[model samples]
Target: MHTPEHILIINVTRIGDTLAATPAINALHEHWPQARISVVGSPHHIEILQNLPGVVRVGALTKNSALFRGWLGAKHFDLAVVYNYDQALVRYALRVARHVVAFRQKSPAINRRLYRCVDPDAYPTVHITEHALKLPVALGIRGANGRILYRCTPDEVDRAKDRLVGRNFDGKRPLIGLQIDSFPTKSYRDWPVESFLALCRRMLARWPQAGFLIYGGPAEMPRTQWLKQQLGDSACLFAGLLSLRETAAQMALTDLYIGVDTGPTHLMSSFDIPIIGLYHPRHPARSLGPKDHPLNFSLDHPHDAAPSSEPQSMSDITVDRVFCQVEKALATRGIS
Candidate 1:
């Protein structure tokens, strides 16, 4: 009912969830072309939104605890879109924005004040981004596109290439990026490292010209390093090396991606590249696989009753099976 000239989006979740809000954000820009967007989020996670279409400014909330109230008292946002159900943020949106759009949280009493909100479970089968669009859709807004808003510049892509060249990567072949580990502690979302290494070997045997870029965070350096060591030659590690923007740029250069159900894997989805995400039975592929990208291929496998190891389902998922999926994805040129 009310159009917000200046909009504030408050998302303080982790990398993946933060990135998950892109499609809806893009749709918001499309629906409201004249609106200026400002976002508040975690330090590193908000980096991806740097060049996002019409985003005027990005503010970090982690480094400054008082930033929330600053956003509220200093600038009055016509509308606030809160992605997660943090009660504090909900309260802030209510105080600052004339209108608020968010997903329904547990405390209906608080959410009842918002201009619009959607039940997250209503579209359980849909991509998370699609669910996000439901918020704007609830506002009688339409034509909101469903693409991630990560914008990589030519310079950044070239920088990624330079980084690769530094690592002895030849520009002649189609690069295949691999992310072997999930979050350091949350290994349940990860497939086995050996499986990735084995998959790399098969990939090398098939496409010798294919290069590998190993991606992970500082916490995942140990596991990522081992995989890089085993992968060897055409392989390079991007763990503690690149900034978030640089990661997107490098991922844009990748021909294909094979990784577990992790944040980086989802972050890589921003680029229009083919990604193979290995999923465990505990968490079904349909549940957490690629959101809107057709190029993403998710392989779901069975697991033991009790969780013996993380990614328990990996034991049942054979390297050949994963390789077959990888080959199939490459065969498509990720056109879908």
Candidate 2:
């Protein structure tokens, strides 16, 4: 295929999945530097891709929006790459773009229509970012650099700093960020709240001046609030108060992050901060942990020792094991 003048990437999914696709989108841009890249994502997450390096446009799309999206429009795109197997999204791409690339759909008729129908299981299980990269790799685009892209403006960074200062986090050394729980549906991935409280006690004992920024959505506020109460003045709770972008900006100022496998953890990976990501056996570190990160200290459940079809407990990841990594991260940064 000739170099396409315009490319469209559709990824209408949750934050983690949306962020996972950025590496593939980066590859597409590297190969075709001049092509105008546009992305359609979930309304809640489309903002995450707004200021990415090569993306010229970022918009929201739902299954409903896909139904009538291209019916009234001309095929102005030369190529379209879609992630996931939503038939509505695939059908919309078919209506609007000359050539489309996606995973092989369940319907044989849909499979027959794709420019490249990638067998999702053809490749061995790998990192989620690499898994998403398979879409662009089908088009001979390579060298993605294996880094998730996120940008915060100078103003945003300044405001984040001011906010941290307002919360009295300015003079705190080894300021750590805590993600108390994963989203509701993936509750299995959450480490117990008591574990987080215990971990904070250990850190405070070591550094004495260590401060924590507890982050979460409204649903997890009870856990985050309890953690704040346990830590007293040493912690500030941003659970139900901050916007996604606001939380991200605040995260960028932290010295370290400790969290479960979730969307905010994925966002933290974009920064150069030290991270300790706790993972469950079903979706272990090997599949979802940060890639090409210099300071990643991700721990997988013991059940991950031998891949299993059965469920395991997040409590299996002990506080001491996590503290060991915390010590190592602090030592690396000369935090003593």
Candidate 3:
């Protein structure tokens, strides 16, 4: 058969896409048990892949540098798969590998011409977890599960709980983790803060015994602060309070997660937690949605208003709509 001794999977996209690529790594490991599998990722994305199975090493790619490319050439990988089409990056991959595979559409042709193109859109319209499995499928490697995989150590889980347990959360109560922010660049994907506040009000009234833990990065702290002011006693703010790994651990303890189309949302889907996804029309819920976890809920408005030039709303999905999803999640747990 068709197998390489050394394989390199390149995905320099955001953290969600980086994590989504793990299934492909697992597929390669299953296909060629002896081949060494390494991945090229950024420092931020590398944290998501750390301690993951089926990965021998993850090389960090410095911004606009030849360092990563130089290593690729030196290592001389037998096969390469480029998940996103970065022309400059593809040139580097082409130089180092005997065979190269890349996504066909929405990619730069100038860079794409250097390698074999695979069309991921031709596959079924499903969750990103399923979409990522196309990488190995296009390579004639098959029979891999579409479920997203994220593994956290037992110590990691305990450390996160210890840090945030007593202050505002009772570990015994079923917690609802809310991520109120998306990336600064993809503001369109973010749900309205007022919508979040309204949902918290309804949930607090409904689940008297339940607690809410809101999380976001440093950049989102101001918004989270504003939200806390709006929500007087309903929720506790943990924005900028924990590291990414800690946030992942906190998610593991959640009974439900409600967030925008963000990396943390994707990260939460890897665990057994139930998710209520807030999606924008521009980023359709069909392909970029969450996978088949225990319970996954998505609210999308495809024909709604368009995204503004900068950080503005994209969809017209209302607070009432999101509250309905919250009710569904609560109902799943037989809270009401």
Which RMSD values do the candidates have, in order?
Answer: 3.4, 1.5, 3.9
Runs in model 2 with CA error above 4 Å?
Answer: 122-124, 307-310
- Residue pairs with backbone overlap in model 1: none
At residue 53, candidate 3 shows an lDDT of 68
The 10-residue segment of model 3 with minimum total lDDT is 304-313
Worst 10 residues of 1 by lDDT: 302-311
- Residue lDDT tens for model 3, 1-336: 256898887878787888778777888888888998788777676777767666788787644753355553363788888776566566667777777877664656543553457666643355676677777887787888665677788999888777555665654355789988897887868877877877777776766666778899889988899988877655677898877888888888878899988888888888766788887766766656676567887776745245344543544677777778777776787656
The segments of candidate 3 whose C-alpha lies over 4 angstroms from its true place after superposition are 71-76, 104-115, 119-131, 232-234, 302-315
lDDT by residue (18-93, candidate 2, tens digit) is 9999899989988899999999989987888878878999999998889988987689899999998899999999
Query: lDDT per residue, candidate 1, 1-336, as tens digits?
Result: 556699988888888778878877777787888999999888767888888887999987652363356453553888888887677777777777788888887897987888886777543366666667777788776766665557888899888878877878856366888887777576766777887888888877777777888887788888889988887776888888878788788888878988887777778777678888887766555656776677877687755234345535565888888887887788777422
Which candidate wins on TM-score?
2
Model 1 ranges off by over 4 Å:
62-75, 106-109, 122-125, 142-145, 302-312, 333-336
For model 3, which pairs clash? none
**Which candidate ranks first by lDDT, i.e. highest?**
2
TM-scores for candidates 1 onward, in order:
0.88, 0.97, 0.84
